[model samples]
Target: MESQAAFNYQQQVEEIRLAMGCDFVALALVQSEERHFQIRWEFASGNLSQRFRRIVLHSGKGVAGIVFKTGKPIFVPDAHQYYKKEDMYNYPILIAEELESFAAIPLFKYNRVKGILLAGCRKQKCMSIEKFELLQSLVTPTFGPYYSEEVTGI
Candidate 1:
């Protein structure tokens, strides 16, 4: 798969954020072998922190990590209710982005999970099921080199 240009990535994420009425939209990509396959938040829209650029995600460690590990999307209509206050700390993106509702989908290339697309809002129930479904649908046959037809989170 061809790598996405930074400008294109930014534009796409920004479009998604606006279309979906999300407070934040981000893409996390797996690093090359030289970087030891770490996952880092690469492109973002509506973000409040620069921490994502420096944080590397491990499999099963966080929202992006869970999606990367499971190859399925995780949608939480209410992050505050779904995750305990203390346990929510484990999900760095939620805290870092101040997300209250969110979902994540795995981006696959060659049958391997290569990236993650996450959308979120800082308000409760802001990421409705319909919206989440729309996001998933929008991703199909598009989203850089990834196709939703060939992959789904859950």
Candidate 2:
């Protein structure tokens, strides 16, 4: 059952990457409580290598971490401009993927961020505001088992 779910997620990630015309797309999911809710890049499409699997992040650490911690979406038109060369190590995913531009959104569950969805390109300024906005609209109310936005009571 778990494998099936992962397969479905992989397909969805690939579809999103294709739809967004990105060079790479990935999903970072929160591990179970046993792992202290650590986040890991579980699925990816159009990746340059398998380095992303080795990355495990705590909230507020990397790109996934920051988005997970803040529960807010982020768009970087130029990774180099947004992050200094000396500070590139802070965003391992971007470095691993060699992404020049990217955007990521928090995936919610039970009003809490449980995952992250990221889309990126290798060319500088390729991820424009319009592209980021389109990615936002694609997620809408939900993305797989997680909600794209936090759910609140009236």
Query: What's the TM-score of every candidate structure?
Result: 0.89, 0.91
Per-residue lDDT of 98 in model 1: 92
RMSD of 1: 3.1
For each candidate, how many residue pairs have backbone atoms clashing (under 3 Å)? 4, 0
Model 2 CA deviation exceeding 4 Å by range: 1-7, 140-142
> Deviation in angstroms for 27 in model 2?
0.2
Predicted structure with the largest TM-score when compared to the true one: 2
- Quality of model 2 by C-alpha lDDT: 0.89
Q: Residues 101-150, candidate 2, lDDT per residue (tens digit)?
A: 99999988778898899999999999999989878877753364576878
lDDT of each: 0.84, 0.89
Which 10-residue window in model 2 sums to the lowest lDDT?
1-10
